[model samples]
Target: MASEQMPPVVTLHEEYGCGAREIGERVAASLGVEYVGRAMKSETIDEIAGDADEGGFVERFLRSFTPIPSHDANIAWALEAHADHEVADQNNRYLADLAQDGAVIHGRAGAHVLADRPATLHVKLIAPLSTRITRAATEAGITPERARHRQAREDRVRTDFCRRLYRWDPRENDRFDLVVNTASFTPEQAADLIVTTYRLHFPV
Candidate 1:
């Protein structure tokens, strides 16, 4: 018999506090695939950029862009750009390796990184800013104001990261094959939609 082909990779991008980790886990479990999330990607990137000096390519490139604690707008922009590029490259490689086995990857620009891959389904999850703030506040046992501040900061970072690295605005629905509004759909519902969509595109 011929070898079984791998399933299509499901890549999910979500706004801060959108429950991506929970939904991603559900999708991975429902599909019996690996769940690759930002935590894992961060660990991988730290390892990749390890104690190597500024002489190492990755280290040198990363160090060259460190933002100075000054009010220089141009310097800050360059710093953010460089940091975004470093992250994008590391994440792209990590996702590329995971793509071989087929996995549900959330965040770390998995969708953008695997955009050209035929066997990848890109999904985006979002919710109203207020809804996200409330959910985050409840989850973290914090004040709504604090949650709102945190969410805003995270959203800004992610927006800049994607714009700098991919020249794409992740909030735009056109970037994803499927966009789920978490306020309207439960995590389970979102996961089911993603699984169903992936299967529709690449049936057994």
Candidate 2:
């Protein structure tokens, strides 16, 4: 539903320590659009749940994360599945609303949520394990060994987030309009490349 008058939307998905947030900020600045980070989307969800206390998404989403007795295992599983779908639907609507104007969204499954929107670019950033571990360690001021462990945990969580909610595997390169290996480019350079591609697809 995008029009020529509206600015383009950009979604960037990256592995841990790939500088997704910084790159997304740069892209947003260059395009003069709002930059929506993963934390912002999560906060929005929390706010929604808080505003609507009971008999709504709050109870279902919370139930998805809590344990139930053995006697209610089947019922719990069903509720969990329903909760996952509800969250996905909410996320999609939120992203769609943002894309109506134009936004550079970092993480929170932006790529999957806005895949069908016109004048939108879907980007993914990746690097080898060694490269990412080194970057993560330097950024967090932690040892490479600890960074590696954190990377494994975070990667699993992100992959599962996409797979469980959207049934989309982000590792599939075909899903992205542009896939950059961040090991080869600085964050600014990556942002430049993405902006160039965006302009090409959605000329101003």
Candidate 3:
């Protein structure tokens, strides 16, 4: 286990199609820390270690975050408060543990999970909806219409996930230490900005 004394951590929350994964990877590379994506994946942790509730929570949480095609366009996931809290507690501990050695965590409400931790930088990446739709379409090689649909579904899901677990809105700028408008910045530029911001906030 890494020591309880943590190094600086960067937690990134982004709107759909905002290039968070790409920028987060770059930031982690620059910082020389682990880039944690889908850390909620079953392969990373035991899927059946606890009671029926724990096992069920893991399955539902995974399904809630699965890629777009598997989800219904019209239906939003209805997560239970009890299960959501269990998952939130688990996520908090796991993220804290990962940050002990420094990490850049993408999505999974990381900003909210580690909001109170010292030496943590919480960033939100977003762009205009129109810009995001275009970027998402171009990146996925999908039609604009399909991209818009997926974007709406994903954005809603992430927002609702935070509301359910943390009672906070992820889109609020006040919740983040820095909010980057990706419409004005490329992934490389955005990564550079975040790294610079982190250094400024916690100078070596």
lDDT of 2 by residue, 1-204 (tens): 345567778999888778787899999999989999874332344454454533354343444455344468788788677777777787888888898778999887888877777788999999988999998888778889878766765666567667778788887877699999999999999999999999988876
TM-score of each: 0.75, 0.82, 0.76
Q: Rank all candidate structures by their lDDT, best first, as comma-separated numbers.
A: 2, 3, 1
Residues 21-84, candidate 3: write the lDDT tens digits: 7899999999889999854322222343233333244345544544224345344333343455
| TM-score leader | 2
Give candidate 2's error at residue 12 in angstroms.
Answer: 0.7
RMSD of 3: 8.8
Clashing pairs in 2: none
Q: Candidate 2: worst 10 consecutive residues by lDDT?
A: 39-48
Query: 58-163, model 1: which lDDT tens digit per residue?
Result: 3333444553354689977676666766666776788889988789988767777788777678898889988888887787788898677667556665566566
| Residue 114, candidate 2: C-alpha displacement in angstroms | 0.7
Q: What residue pairs clash in candidate 1, if any at all?
A: none
